[model samples]
Target: MTVEQNSAPDTAQIQLTPDESIVLFELLSRWCEDGKSPTPEASCFESTAEGAVLHGLLADLAKQLIAPSKADYDSLLNGARDRLKGNWDFPTLRG
Candidate 1:
């Protein structure tokens, strides 16, 4: 098996029914929209910033769902993760 395949979490395999599938997709879409622009100019649903971001998220999650490899996943997210970690992870703002 490929390294990417191995890194994926077992939870990713949970079979969602059609309804549940749509719910997850919608949640991801709304999340991207909230993070992106709520009034984005893209006319096509698939062409919206939310769509692109959500696509990337899904692709990355597919590659490394759990126990992600540093080189493949953590490395890519390191900067953002590091930047946000201090503010969100710690109780105090003191460095």
Candidate 2:
């Protein structure tokens, strides 16, 4: 049996405001921390490929976000959230 492999690039580029990026980075970081693996063999997530992608994204965000590493991160993040809320309308979830 022969298998065909696609050679398309596996990377993507996205643009986000600094506020948005910081907020998302905080969310992702918390998610990763909550999903820590017990066994050494198992990675931080259930799926290795997806986990790797998330980790890479987190790393990228870390490089781009200075607020997360600052002493006033909570205040910075809250300000970001407030700015985002003002910029866009988010529909409330319905039961």
Candidate 3:
């Protein structure tokens, strides 16, 4: 029997502000607890309070992006990209 290890990196590198770190971790933690991954759309969504809040957040972000009229439209767009950026992964983050 034998064992081997790979030393390659699997994620990417990017940056996020302190607030983004908090929000991104919270969001990922919730999905992970349910054994789910965040997708552009959640197919297994329920209409419960928490589920509704999650869906609502997605919808609001979408609406602002489409209309571009909201005060924080640009910031919102950047925040999403920053949060889900590849660097959010552990190895890249810790590095």
The number of the candidate with the highest TM-score is 2
Compose the digit string of candidate 1's lDDT tens values, residues 67-95: 23335443434444555445456565452
User: Least lDDT summed over 10 consecutive residues: which range in candidate 1?
Assistant: 17-26
Q: Candidate 3 on 1-95: residue-level lDDT in tens? A: 23334655466544655445445544644564445665435555554666666655545444433323557745764776676676455664246
- Put the candidates in lDDT order, highest first: 2, 3, 1
lDDT of 3: 0.52
Quote each prediction's TM-score: 0.27, 0.64, 0.27
Cα displacement (Å) at residue 37, model 2: 14
- Estimate candidate 1's alpha-carbon lDDT, on a 0 to 1 scale: 0.51
List per-prediction Cα lDDT, in the order shown: 0.51, 0.78, 0.52
Q: Which candidate should be chosen as best, given lDDT against the real structure?
A: 2
**Tens digits of lDDT, candidate 2, 1-95:** 33344655467689999888998898778766656633234553577787778878988898887888899999999998998887656675231
